[model samples]
Structures are given as structure tokens and as C-alpha cells.
Target: MSTWRIRLSLFLNFFVFAILLNTVGIVIKRVIDDYGVSEAMAASLEAYKDLSIAVGSFFLASYIPRFGYRRSMLVALLAVTIASMGVAVITGFWITPVLYMTIGVSFALIKGAVYSTVGLITRDQGEHTSLMNLLEGIFQVGALAGPLFFSVVMGLHFSWNQTYWIVALLSALAYLLLLITPLDESEVQSHPEQAGLVEMLKLLRWPLVWVFVLCAWLYVMIEQSFGTWLPTFHERIFGLDKHIAAGMLSVYAGSIALSRFVMSYLSRRIPWLPTQLTMLGGAFVLIVSILLTTAGWQGTTVDSWVAVPPLAWVFSMMGFFIGAIYPTIISIVLNKLEKPRHAAMTGLIIIFSALGGTTGSFVVGFISRSFSTHDAFYFPLIPITLLALMLIPYKRLADRFHPASPGG
Candidate 1:
């Protein structure tokens, strides 16, 4: 198939997969209502999904090149399709943990392959980052649409489980599309000397890899915290109905998608440092705003949803900045590594990102329990600060080792 055909296939694949991956925020509310789980218990679902992704990535990272990207993604799509169908058919929400575990494992396979495939297609750093932004933008589109889709189904009085049926069908279609698109995996660089378990582990010894890993972990933590809990946050703080709460979550995802779409264009015109630093600065401002608004909510009474704090909008819209960090970091990391180790490095990225997602969700739940839901909003500030500080080192390391010149 043509290059554009391949990109289209991968784009659609991510679009559908995102709906499954980003459903945690809505599911948090569903499990609470349907299964009568506590807030912490409901939040534990993220650990199930993310920990499984980490484990799957660890086992499959070194072997993805041998398995071939196209084959691995097909299997991943099949696995998620089956799992979603099972979840839809199962009664009650007791099957939730198992369902998420299945989704997590499937995502690990798809992501490891997908990240590696980007390196194969792009000719240089600029192309790589732009493409990553485009793909992530598409993924956010799915994230944006997912909550709205959930709200519609629930508003129509359908059982929440029926939502998985939509996921299953979309995943199955993505599978067929990928199957038809031919991928030239033979073009992906491989080194016979660095194609095994020891070689992959050796990547961990590099300080730069650890830096990228930390960056990935922290970025995902912020992204998933909002993605997984924003709906509940709105519902609780604003006293919004289930559909409205979920719809507001879509607004957040939509902001991220919109920003990413803009970044896909702007990244080509602006230098990487300026574009990234500007987004981080925006995040710092918005997060501080969110913290201030939530802290001062003590004497307020919400007589109607309209009386709810507008900071809730800031909390959701912060995705504009949060969206760029992860993909931009992955793009930079991929540019730094030799192509031979791209698959292995991509696995590490997913592993740390999984770790971040797991930790962020749990921490938010813990803080909410210990203090209040508003207090949990403060947890992201820690990573946001660390992420901003780390960029200095990341830039220095990048310039020293991987100059923007082609084949650096």
C-alpha cells in the first residue's frame, strides 16, 4: 500500500483504540453507581489497565521486530475486540477488573508496534514529531468523542455495558483496515548485535533513556489523572448529571485534540524548544488557576449547575498543554536513539507511561479520601513542576547527542 494508505490505517487504528483506552473517566462513575464501589476502589481500575500494559510491554518489547509490527497490531485489535464483546455481554460490573486487564495487555502490543512503526516511516526528526503530533491528535479525537458517545448511550437509557459493543465493532473494523494495508516492516532498521533481551536492558543504563522514561511517566500521570477522573470531578463539584458530566469530560478531551491538531501545523513552523516551553508555561498558569479556584470553594453553594465553579472548565481545558508533553517527548526520544533500538526504547516509554498512569490515578484517589476531591487536584502540580524543570536537561542532552541535523 501507499504511504498515505498506511498512515490512514494507523490513524484509524489509534482513533478507535483511544475510545477503549480513554473510557476510564466515564467508567469511574459507572462502576461507582453500578457496582457501588468506593472512590478509591473505582480508581483502582486504572492500576489494572496500566499495570497490565507495563507487563505486556516488558515481555514483548524485544520481540516486536521479530513478530512484525503489522502482525502484532492485528493480534492486539483482535484481542481487544474479543475482550470488549465479553465485557458487553457480561452482567453487572463485576467483570470490570478482568475487562480492563485485557484492554491493557492489548494496548501494550498495539503501542509498542505503533511507536516503532513511526520511526520506520519518518525520514527525519521534524517529520517524526509532526507525525506523532498528528497521530496523537487523532487519538485525542477519539478521546473527545468517547465521552460524548458515552453520554448519548446513557442518555438514551441503554445499559452502560452496551457502550463496549460500540468499542468492539469499531476495533474489529480497524482490524480489517489494518489487515488490508500493506506495511513494509523490512524497511525498519534492525541490528543483529542489539536484538535480544540483554541488548534491550542495556538501554536502561543510559541516563538519557531514564530521563525520557521519567518524562513519559510524569506526562502520562497528568494526562490520565484528568482523563480518568475529570467526569467524576465535575459530577461531584458541579452537581452535574451523569450525561452532562461525561459531556464536560469530552470538552476537556476536545481541547487537547484541538491543540494537538494545531500543533501538528505549528510544530513545522516553530522550533521545538519554543513550542514546548510555551505549552508548559500555559500549563503552569492553568494548573495554578485550578488550584486557587478549588482552594477557595469553601463558602460556595451550588444552587444549580450554572453556579458551579468555572475553574472546572480550566481543569478540563488544561489538556491543551498536557496533550503536547507526551508525544513531543516520545518524538525527541526516538530521534535520540539509533533506529536499531527504537522498538526496545518504545517499550520502555510505554512501561513508564503505564507506571505514571497507575500512580497518578491511585494518588488522586488517595488524596481525595484523605482530604477532599479538590485536594486531589493538587497532585498534578508536583509532576508539572518536575516536568518543567527536566526540560532544561532534556534540551541540553538532546543538543549534545542528537543535533537536529539529519542522521544526527
Candidate 2:
């Protein structure tokens, strides 16, 4: 089978979803201004999107191998494409949640298929880690471009809703590419009877899986806190123009993309645990420094990047340090499991990740509304500290369970 075509299709599918998923921050800002929604109400968008992801992944993910990876991805693309078109034609605050619900459900299928497909395409643990990083790196690229795409669209005198038309076009293109791509799932499909919700839920029986789940959950909480709110932070905290605030998220996404690409190269050279720990430490220091320096600081209105505070730039760099953590942890867990179990395991991961993202965004939104944006930024410190502590045991368990696995 030609793996490159399948790989390209996966990349395109992931890229499309990344843009739609990460645009929550920008969309949140827009709904507040255009629809007159409050911060807490806007935060429900995350719940709409993420809760659907959790529900979809829980029900559909285990069966994906039998349903076929290619078919699952194609279905996801088609659904999101239609949803985007619907949002473009229909304009209202009510429609926004509907669009995101579509996006969330569709992403569950796309992500489950992509993660499982990586196992089929790769030959070994090292290859798995490298490909995972590259795949996630591409996701970050989409994340980086998503805000910029919105900025440019709005800059052309188009409303944010019109951005969905372009997204619909992109989804159509990805759907076509995936429709033509061939993926061989015979290995995973061999025991079709074993793929079930019961078996998938059984993954939680293992202590390692539980610990890993907590880690995944905490990591995403931290990630979504920033990913879903940075634009709002920049806009409100720094008093920047909305477009500039939204565009500034590119810094965060770009840093993450760069870090993941770098990790793709370095994963082979460095130990995963130490590298992850070091990155967490760096993130901890930077986040603390930003919190201290920006405390009680009133932001002045800034029209351009030149006037944006240097500390805001420092805060964005948190992405660079944390970017590699998710893929690295995923690679570690999946590398230890047999290929047949990859889809089920990935389903479990996605479920927790979605829950984490939803919870994190809600908490931050509450904090920002109740307290202040600066206070909201401090929420990540708890997760960061917990994730750092969790890594030690996770590393030990990985080694104990799979002594010879490259991920250890």
C-alpha cells in the first residue's frame, strides 16, 4: 500500500480540524462583541464542542477500526463541511453552538482515526513518536494559521461568520483527498469482535492508564486555558484591538509548532521523561514570571505589536515548552500497547482530553469573569505543578510495564 497518500490525507484532515477547533478563542471574543453574550455564556461554546467530542468518542471510537479509518475520516469531513456551510448561511448566537457541536463530534472521528492510523503506518516506537510529533506539529501549524485566517477575513470587511465559507471550502478539499486515499486496516480489523465499548472501557482497569489519563486531563486543562483564552487575555488584559489580539495567538501556536517539530528530531536523541520534565520546568518559570510582573498592571490600548507589552510575548512562549508534552505522552502509552488496541486506547485519551479542555475553559472563563483576566492566567499554575508531579510516576510505570519499549 502507498503510505504517503494516506499520510498526506491524515495531515490535511488534521489540519482542517485544528483550524476549526482552535478558533474557539477567536469565536468567543467575536460572540461577546457581536451577539452581546457574557463571558460565562460564551464559555458554553467550549462545553458544546467538547461535550460532544466526549460523547462521540466514547460511543464511536472503539468501533472505528471495524468501520474503517478512511470511512470514518471521510464521514467527519463531510459533516463538518456541511456544518460550516450552515453557519455561513445562518447567522445568530444560537447557530454558533450548533456549529461547534458539529465540529466537536466530527473531530472525535477524525482524531480517533488519525491516531489509530499512525500505529498502522509506523513500524516501531521511534517511528511512532516521530510521526506523532510531526502530525501534532502540523496541527499546531493549523492552529497558528486559524487566527490569522480569521484576521485576514475580517480585515477584508467580512464578518466572522463569513469565515465559515472558506472553512467549508477547505473541508471539501480535505474530504476529496481523504475519499481518494487508501488505508489498510486489516491488522486492526482482524478481530472485529473484540472491538467494543466493554473492551474500550476495560482500558481504565490498568493503573498506568488511570495515571496517564489524569496526566492527559491535567495537560489539556493547562493547554485549553491558554488556547481558548489567550486572545481574550490579549484583548482585555493588554487593551489591544480585537484583530491584533486574535492575530497574536499565532505567536503561541507558532511556538508550539516549532517545539513539536524540534521534538520530532530530538525524541530519538533524548530521554522522553527528562525532556518532558525540563520543558515543564521551563514553562513553570515563565508562567510564574509573567504572573508576577503583570500583577495589577493596567493595560493601555495598543494598536500595533510594537506597543504590545514584552511580557505578553513571554506569556505566549509557554506554548514552546508545553507543545511536546501531549504527543510525547501519547506516543509513550500507545507504543506500549499492541496495534489492535490503539484505537480503543486513543478513544480513552480523547475522552479525557475533551473533558479537560471543557473544564479548563469553563474555569478560566469563570475566573476571568468573576475576578480578572490576570487572575485567570494564574489557574494554569495548579495544573502545571500537578502535571510535573505526575510525570515521575508515569515514567516509572512506563518503564515497569514496558521495560524494553523505546518510549521508556
Candidate 3:
């Protein structure tokens, strides 16, 4: 494939991924209610998912240079397709945790490889930022659309177990699309020094690398927290019916998708630091607003008899503003690393991200299960606030490693 072909293929692949990743968020409560599992066990679904991503990424990191990015992604696509089918095959309350865990692992392999491929197709910092922003926006498209698709499924009164099979079929289509598009993995730099294991390790240790890695990881946590628990929160905290609560969930995901898509355009017009700062600033303010709004809830109980919170629309709309984060952070981080090391760094970060997602979902699940989902709000704020503070150090780190933009 030509450069643009590779980039576009990878970009389209992200939409497929976003669909799979956010689908579970739509039916989380149904899974729990249907299967009789504890909150901790429910959380373990994410734990296993994270654990698999970490493991697969760690092992596959070295192979991008050896086999090829396209082949790696093809394998990942297959894993997701099979794993999704597996969930439907084994339907037990106790086994649901294990099934969800497999889903996490499959996504890890699929996404880890897909995310790292951006460095391969781009030639410079601006191209990196623009492409990542555009494609990551596509990812948000899938995330937003996944929930809406499930809403249609629920409307038809489809069972939760059947949904996985539906998602799996979509992934199978993506896998075939990838197979048809030939991929060429390029480490354009011929420097033998740049292509070794120790070199990759040194890059991973850099403060610039960690700031972005940590930022991306925790940001993912915030995303997953809202993605997994928000629908339940919407239903419980507000008095919306199931479909209506789900519509609110879609609104949040849709807003996030919209923001990320907008970032693609913004990246072309502005510098990375300023764009990121604005988004993070907005994120912190909105997060605080959400916290304050939830403070006067009186109790954790779902008073279905009462009206839903008026500010639900406000907070749901906030997701679009926060959507710029994941892609922007990746673009900033990859600017620091050379092409050859991008895959390994992607592998390493993905493990942590999976961990973050697992931690985010399960921790909130436990809190909700142990106390109330209401108590879970406090848990996400601390990390999200810390993520905002991280930008200061990130800006300095970017300056230290990369010179001021010539065109930027």
C-alpha cells in the first residue's frame, strides 16, 4: 500500500475498534443483572482485558520491525473476532467474568497494534498530529455509534449475549478489510543504533515518554469510568427509563466522538501545546462541574419516583470537549520518539492503558457494588485532576526534547 492507503486503512480500522470497545458500556448493567455476578467479579472482566493487552503488547512489541505492522494487525483482528464469538458460546453467570476478561485481551492486541501503526505512515510531527487526530476521531465515531447500535438491539429486545456475536461479526468484516489492504512497515531510518532493544528501553525511560504514557493511561481510565458506569449512573441518579438512560450514554459518547473529529481540524490550525491545554482546561472545569452537581444528591438511592437531574444534558455534552485528549496526547508523545521505537512504546503504553481501563471499571464497579455507584464519582476525580496537572510537565518535556516548530 502507498503511504496514504496505509494511513487511511489504519484510520478506518479505528472506527471498527471504537465500536467494539464502547459496546460493552451500553449493556454493562444488563450483563450484571442477567448473570448474577458480584461487582468485583464484574470488574474482573476489565482486569482480564487489561491483563491480556499488557501481555500481548509486551510480547508483540518486538515483532512490528520483524514481521510487519499489517500482519500484526491482521492477527489482532482475528483474535477480536474469535473472542467476541467466544462470549456468546459460553453463557454462565460465573463464566461471564471470564468471557469479559477475554474480550479485554482481544481488544488489547487489536488496539495496541492499530494505535502504534500511526508512526509508520507519517513523515513528520505535523503529519503525525493531523493523522492521529483524524483517525482517533474516527475511533470516537465507533465509540459513539456502538451504543446507538445497541440501543437498536435493545429496542428489538435482543439479549446481551447475542450482542457480542453482532459485534464479533463486524470485527470479522474489519479483519477482512485489513487483509485486502496490503501493509508495508517502514523504519525509514537506517541507523542501526536506533533499531535495537536497549535503544527502545532508553526511550521508554524518558520523562517525556512517561508523562504522555501516564497521561494517556489515566485519561483512558476517565474515559472507561464514564463509558462503563455512566449509563447505570444515569439510570440510577436520574429517573430515566432504560432506553432514555442509554440515550444519555450515547450523547456522552457522541459528544466525545464529535470533539475528537474536531481536533483533527484543530491540529492543522494550531500548535499541539495550546490545543491540548485548552482541552485539558475544559476537561478539568467540566469534571469539577460534574462533581459539584452530584454533591447534593441527598442519598445514593435511585428515586425513580422523582425527576432526573436537570444538568444531565450539560455533563453529557461535556464528553465532546474531553474527546481531544487521547489522540492529542499520542501525537505529542510520538513526536518525541523516532519511528523505530514507536511500536514498542505503543506496546508498553497499551499495557498500562489496559490496566487503567481495568482499574477504572472494576474499581468503580466495586465502589458501586460495595457502597453505591454514587461514591464512585469521588474516585475518578482525583486521577482526572492529576491528568490535567500533567500537561505542565508535558509541555516542558516536549520543549526539552523537540525544538520549536518551524511551520507550527
Candidate 4:
């Protein structure tokens, strides 16, 4: 089998989902302005999306290998394609939840399948780490495109629902690509009997797994706080037009994409832990400076990126420091495990990640509702600190598990 086609299919799979998943922030801003929903109500879109991911990953991840990775991804794409079309036609705030719910569940399948399939294609830890970062970088590219895509649609004076029509089309194309791409799943299927809920549950019993789970949870909490709410932050706090605010979010996504691409090269030459820690520190300082700079300033309407506050640009820069964190941690943990356990392990990672994203978005939204969006920005500081602390133990355990592997 040609690995390149399989890899292309995987990249396309992630690219499509990245756009769908990261559009939460853009959609939240839309519902608030167009549908007249409150911050908290709009925030529920994250819950509807992420909680479904958590639930779907918990129950379906372990069994994906048995179901076949290609088949799983195809089904996920089909589901989301249909859901996006429904949202495009239905055209109501109420239908928004259903679209997100479909995305969440479908992504659960896509992520698990994609992560597990990486283990099948790669030959060693270095290849695994490099490919994971590259895949995630492509994901960030799609994420960047998502906001920009919506910005164009809104700029043309189209309803946000119309954006779903394009999403549906992209998903349909991805579905066709995966359908034709052949994947060899024999290695994972060799022990199909071992792949089940019992084996997945057993992963929870490991101390190292729990530590890693904590790391995933915290990292995603920080990332989602920005990914799911940054547009709203700019629109509400910086007083940018809705389309411009969404367009500005592309800066954040683009930063992450660039950072991850850089990491794909640097992960081989550099130490992961130190690099990650330094990135976290940079993020912590940047967030504090942004919050302090933007404080007490009443929002003013701005029509162009040129007129946007300089400090507002700093908000998107947060992506530069934090982009590599997710793929690095995922590569580290999955690299430590055997191929047979990759799907199950990836499932655990997805479950915690979904939960963390939901918690972060909801907490920030609630805080924004109760206090202000500026005040809400402070919430990620807590997770950033906790994640930095958690990394120490996570790195130690990862080293203990694979003594021959590079500890960093």
C-alpha cells in the first residue's frame, strides 16, 4: 500500500474537522449578535459540541480499530456533511446545537482513527512525533481558514447559516478522498478481541496515564479558552466588527499553524519538555500583559485590522506559544504505548481533551457573563500555571516508561 495516499487522506480528514471544530468561537459570536443569545447561552454551543466528543470518544474509541479506521473516518465525514447541510437549510439558533453535536460526535471518531492510524504508518518515535506535529499543523491551517472563511461569508452579507453549505461541501470532498484511500489495519486488528471497553477502562488504572490525562486536560482547557472565545473577546472587548473579529482570530490560528510546523522540525533536534515549558512561560507573560493592557478601555467600533488595538494583536499571539503543546504531549504519551493500545490511549486523550475544552469555554463564558470578557481572560492563567506544574511529573513518568527513549 502507498503510505502517501493514506497520509494525504489523514491530513484531509484532520483539515476538514479542524475547521468545523474551531468554528465554535465564530459561531458563538454570530448567535449572540444575530440570534440575541446571551454569552452563557451561546457558550452552551461548546458544551453541546465537546461533551458529545467526550461521550463518543469514551464509548467508541476503543472499538474503532475493530470497526476499521478508514471506515470510521468515512462514517464521521458523512455524518458531519449531512449535519452541516441540515444547519444550512434549517436556519435557526436552535438548530445550531444539533450541528455542533454532530460535529462533536463525528470528530470523536475522526480523531481516534487518525491518531491510531499514525502509529500504523510510522516506524519509530521520531517519525511519530514529527508526523503528529505536521498533522496538527495542518489542522491549525484548517482552523485558520475556518474563521477567514466565515469572515468572507459575513463580509458578503450572507447569513452565517450559509457558511454551513460550504462546510458540507468540504466534508463531502474529504469523505470521497478517504473512501478511495486504502489503509492497512491488519496490525491493529490482529488483537481485535483485546480492543474493548474493559481494556480501555484498564488504562485509567495507570498512574502515568492519569498524570498524562491531567496534562491533556489542562492543555486543552487553555487552548479552547482561546480557540472557542477569542472572537467574542475581540468583538466584545476590542469593539471590532463581527467579521473583523473573526478575521482577527485567523491570526491566532495561523500562529498555531506556524508554531506547530516549526515544532515538526525542532522536535527532532530539541528537548520537548524544556521547549514546552518555555512556551508556557511565554504564554503566561503574554496573557498577563494583554489583560492588563486592555483593562478599563471601553470598546470602540473598528472596521479594519489596521485600526485594531495593538494590544488586541497580542491576544492572537497566544497561539504562537501554545500551539505545539497539544501535539507534543500527544506524541509523548502515544509514543510510550504499544501499537495495540494506541487507539485506546488516544481515546483517553480525546475524552479528557473534550472535557477540558468544555470546562474552559463554559467557565470563560460564565465569567464573561457575570463580570466582563476582560475579566474572563484571566481564567486561562490558572490552567497555564497548573499545566506547567503537571509537565514535570508527566515527563518523569514518560521517561520511566521508556528508559531508552529521549526523556525530553
Candidate 5:
């Protein structure tokens, strides 16, 4: 009923969504071994989910204001709840694409609605960034739990399909919680421009929007590549057991949550754009160093701290830096626009992020399938470097357009 209650409900819903979203990564090896699909085939699952999100968001985003964020979220929750059940009941590898597609489309609605609502609730860019970071931090905690939870379910003699039932139950609970809460769309400020397909197209006219789009795309690409493929990389490169490999991914996911938690506070003191560029630089150097070092190591083992390359530690911990980029950029973009455009811009944000995710998974999968997983690490280096470079121009644009709250 109250504002905080709605925000709380959103956090819970996003947490549930995060688990289901990350499952593709956790289950990739299982899909490969169970279904006999190649690495590329398993990797294409990202495309199914992300492209669905992209297409769905592109088409459905403008309608959020008309349908109301609350109603759209209700539909999204119910849809995903049913879809998760479908995942459990459905049999065989052929169902995988359908399962991912259902989740992707449902999430498109949920994300467009929730992000739009956030812009409504927060008073200014500072609060917006903080709340966004906190919400995403909760999502990362769910991601951190995903692989470990999947491994636990598998170890208990449960089928991987059973994981969907957990998602189903969580969604059901989130749906019920939201059912009772009140959301006031009128409290939100409306954009001066008319709300429709035309207005959505008009947003692309701004050069700043393009920069944010590319930045969002690059960040998600890197995030998904690591999120979707890290388990397979560990298992394939190091010969670790599935459970161990999956558990290792928690490091990456956990760092995201931890870093954002830190950023929610650091945002109060540190300048955002400068800090972000420095972190990206560190990430580029770390990833390149890992690739070179990994090539020289004859055999891979997860046996001991001393045995493994420092890459694993640095790579997993890279999430600390990467975590703040997305939410911060989202805040930056939304802050630049009027209230009416927030919903559509959020959709565009999802669109590029989804496209980037699809491209990242496909590229990494193709490279890993054709060459080695180690070599696939080279792919992200370009994006990382480019992201840092793009930020220089983006900072100028933000300062020029929003002088009062330049970094917020």
C-alpha cells in the first residue's frame, strides 16, 4: 500500500526473476550432456531468452503507461508462474527453447514495468540510483544463490527440471504479495511528449541516448557472457565437477551484490563516471592477463588456492566493478528524460542489453566451441576497453544536459 511496500515487493519479484534467469547458465552443461547438443547449441539458449526479451520489450514498452505498471506486473508474474510450471511438466531438450522464450517474454513486461515504477517512486537522480542499485543487489543475491541451489537440488537426486518448481512457487508468492499492495500511477510525473510508438522512436534522436544504449549493451554483454558461460568454462577448462564449477559461479554473482551494496554507499561520496572508468580499465587488464596466463598452464585444477591461476580470483571478483555500471547508467539515462519517457527508455535499455547478451553468449559459445574457452575471454576485452572510452564522451554529454546533478 505504501511506497516502501511496493519497492519491497519489487525487490522480491526481481529476486525470483534473477534465479530463473541465471538457471540457463547453471543448466548449460546438463543440457549438453543430457541432450547431446554442442556448446554453441546450448549457448544459443541465451539468444532465445534475450532476443525474446528484446523483441517483446521493443513492442510492449509503450503500453505500460496505458495498461498501468501494477496490472502489467500482475500479468507478468502470473505468466512466469505458469511458465515455470510448464518447464517442470515439459520433457526433453526441445522444450528448452520454449521454456526460455516464455521466461524472456514475461520478464520483458516485468522489467519495463518495474523500472518505470522506480522512476515514479524516487524523487531525484540520487535516490533513483540508490534504489536501483539496491534492487539489482537483491537480484544478484538471487543469482549468487542460483547455481549453488541448482547443484544442491541435483545432488539430492532431483531432476534439474525440478528447479522450475521452485521458481514457480516463488513467483506465486510474489504475485500474492503484489495482489494486495496498492500502486498509484498518478503520483508519477508524465513526460511532456505524447506517449506512443512515435514518441519512443523520437528518443533515438538524441546522441546521448545512443551512448547510453551502447554502454548498456556492452555491460550486459559482459555480464551475461560470464553469467551464462562461467560454469561451463570452469568445468571444461579446469575439469572440475559440475557441483564445484557451479558453486564457483557464486563468486561472480556474489561480487555483483557485494559491490553494489558498497556502491549504494560510495555513490554518496565518490564521483560516478570517473570511478567507473577506472574499474573498467582494471577489468580489461585483469581479463587479458588471465588469457595469457591460462594459455601457458598445461593442466587446470581447482584443487587449491596455490594451484589455480590468479585469474579465477580476479575474474570472479570483477563483478565488484561491473555491478554498478548498469544501474548507474540506467539512472543517468532516465534522469536525462521526462517522466513519460522513462518507461519507453527502460524498454530501450532492456532492448540493447538483451541484444548485447545475445551477441555475447553466441560469440563466446562459438569461440569456445571452435577453439578454447580461454581464447573466448579475449572477446570481452574489446567491449571493456570501448566502454571505458565511451564514458569520456558520455560524461561530457551528461554534464552538458544535466549540469545540476551531473553524476547522479
Candidate 6:
């Protein structure tokens, strides 16, 4: 298969993966509530998905080059298709956890394989950043639209559980795309004898890797907290109408996608540290402004929008500025590792990245539940602070890893 064809397939597959992931958080909530599972236990379903991804990535890290990216993604798509259909068929609350765990497993493969493949297809930072940025923006579109798509379906037909079938069909179509598209063999894994997990760990002995993982994990929690739950937060605390609350999330994610599109070009001019630090610091101001202006967004009604609240604007700004940081982190990861070790390192990076996704609900849930929901917004500040502090070090390290691309 042609390399461009493979790249297209990868982008489409990744977009499909994004929708499934973002939608599930909204989907399972109704099912779990109806099942009468406590909020915390029901929420743990997502954590299981992350845990599975982390474990799967860890174990499967070494062999992806052997199986190949297309095959790994294909297998992951099939798993998701089956899991989505299973949720539609099953009635017992007992099975929801299993299906979610299965999703975690599938997503682990697709994400680990897909993210690393970005490095494989492109030549250097500029081309890679542009492609990753464009693709990630579309993923955010899917994220923004997926929940609303389900919302419309549930609204029109009141068939909440039935929503899984549509996702199943989409997954099956993506599976077919994988089957038909050609794949490039991953350079990281072409060898007959690749580094084993133990050997992989020797490379990971660098403290920098763990630091990056923590940064990835924390940023996810922050973004997902507002992205996934911001609507609810607005609905409950600010007395914003439901429609407006939902739109609030749109503005946030839309901004994220937009920023990345620009960062695709912007990265060419400014260094990553300065760029990241500026965005992070800006986000810090927004977060504090958000918390201070609203009297606390705990129980705002969904139907009533009493003019756009000031904090709603903060969420929108956060989304746009936060966009490139993720792909930036991945770029840094790819640059840091030598070619032979890239596949294994990519897997662990993806695992923590996935963990960050899973951490979204737990962080929000526990923080909001233990303290006031309004206070929960402050939780993300801790990681944002850490990421900002690391900016100088990250830059110094990034220089050794990725010297500037030669001048035009």
C-alpha cells in the first residue's frame, strides 16, 4: 500500500477512536445511574479502561513492529466494534464494566500504534507537527460532536442504550478501512530481535520519561475535567441553560483544535518551552478568573441561560490554548528516544497518556465530591503549575533531543 494511503487511514482511524472515547463518558453515565451503581463505582468503569490500556501497552509495546501498525489498528478496531455491539446487546449492569474494560484494551492498541506511527510517516518536526495538528483538530471535532450526536439520538428517540449500535457500525466501517489500506513496516520494530521489556526499562531509567508521563497525565485531567464535565459544571453551578452549557464545551474544544492548527505553523518560529510556558501561564490566569467570578457552579439549571457567564469564556480560551501541548509532548517523546527504542517508549508514553484520559473522571469526581464542586476547578492548577515549572528544563532537554530543523 502507498504511504499516503496509510497516513490517511491512520488519521481516519484515530478520529474514529476519539469519538468512541469521548462519547462513552456521556453514554455510560445514564446506564450506570439506571443500574443504581453509586457514582464513584460507576465512574471507576473509565479507570478500568485506562488501566487496561496501560497494561496492554506495557505488554504489547515490544511486538507492535512485528504485528505492524495496520494490523494492530485493525485488531483494535475489531475489538471496539465487538465491545460496542456487546453493550447494545447486554442488559445486565454487570457487563458494563467488562465492555468498558474491553474498550480500554482496544484503545490501548490503536492509540499506542497510531500515535507512534505519526513519527514513522513524516520526515521531521515540521511535517510531523502539521499532520499531527490537523489530525488532532479533527479528533477534537469528533469529541465535540460525539456526545451531541448521542444527545440528539437520545433526544429524538429516547433510545439511550441503542446509541452503542451506531458506534458499532462506525467501528466496523473503520475496521474495513484498515483491512483495505496498505501499511508501512515500523522501523522501530523491523528487527527479528527487538528490545524486551526489561531492556526497554533500561532506556526508561531516565527520570525525564517519568516526568513527561506525569505532565501528560495531569494535562489530560485538566482538559478532560472541563471538556467532559464542564457542561455539567456550568449547569449545576452557574445556572446556565443546558444548551448553553453544552455549547460551553464546544467553544473550549474548538479553541483547542484551532490553536493546534496555528501551532502547526507557530512551532516553526518559537521554541516549545516558551510556547508551552506562555500557554500554560495564560491558562492559569483563566482558571483563577473562572473560579473567582462565578459564585460557584454547583446547581445551575440546564434550560435557563441567564446571559453567558464570565467563567464560560474561560473554558473556551483554555481549550484553544491547550491544543498543541499534547502533540507537542508526543513530538518530544519521539525525539528523545533513539530509533531502536522508539516503539517501546511510545507504548509507555501512550499508556500514561491513556491513563491521563482515565484520570479525568476520578480527579473531577473525588475533588468535587470531597470538597465543593466549585473548588474542584482548582485541582487542575497543581499540574499546570508543575508543567510550567518544568518548561526551562524541558527546553534544555528538548535541545539535545531535537536540534532546530535547518533554516528555510
- The TM-score of candidate 1 is 0.84
TM-score of 2: 0.87
The lDDT for every candidate, in the order shown, is 0.79, 0.86, 0.69, 0.86, 0.80, 0.72
- Per residue, candidate 3 scores C-alpha lDDT tens digits across 1-408 of 377666666766676677765665444566678876666666666555556556666665644555456776777677667766877677776555555555555555555466567776667777777777787777777777776676677788977667677778877877877777765554533433444345546666566777777888788888888877887877676556666676677678778878877777777778866666677677668767777777656534344424556667777776776677787878777767666666666776776777788778888899999888777866877777788789788878786774233211
**Which residue pairs come into collision in candidate 5?**
191-340
TM-score of 4: 0.85
What are the per-residue Cα lDDT tens digits for candidate 1 across 1-408? Answer: 357877887898898778887888679888898878899999889789878888887887767777778998999899888888988898766688888888888787787788878887888877888888889999988876776678799999998889888888989988998888888876553454555556678787766777778888888888878877887777776566666676677778888877777777777677877777778788878877767766645534344556556776667788898787677778888878776577788778777777788789889988988998777877888888888888778877776765224333
State each candidate's clash count: 0, 0, 2, 0, 1, 15
Best by TM-score: 2
Cα lDDT of candidate 1 equals 0.79
Per-residue lDDT of 1-408 in model 6, one digit per residue for the tens?
346777777767777777777766675687666777787877787777667777877887656666676787888888878887887888766777787777777776776577667777777776776677777877887777778778888898766767778878888888887787765565666663554576456555665666667777877777777776777777777777777877777788889989888887777677677788888888888888777877533543545444676656666678776778888876776665654456677677776766676687678778888887778878878878887776566655555643122110
Model 2: residues with Cα > 4 Å off, grouped in runs: 24-46, 89-98, 158-162, 229-243, 295-301, 362-378, 402-408
* Runs in model 6 lying further than 4 Å from the true structure: 32-44, 89-95, 228-237, 241-247, 268-270, 294-302, 354-376, 402-408
Segments of candidate 3 deviating more than 4 angstroms: 25-44, 82-106, 148-169, 188-201, 232-237, 241-243, 289-310, 358-385, 402-408
Better of 3 and 4 by TM-score: 4
Q: How does residue 110 of candidate 5 score in lDDT?
A: 87
Residue pairs of candidate 1 with colliding backbone atoms: none
What's model 3's lDDT at 274? 67
lDDT of 5 by residue, 195-253 (tens): 55676777887778888899998898998888778878766666666666666777888
Query: Which candidate would rank higher by lDDT, 3 or 5?
Result: 5
For model 3, name the residue pairs that clash. Answer: 49-104, 255-320
Error of 3 at 376 (Å): 5.9
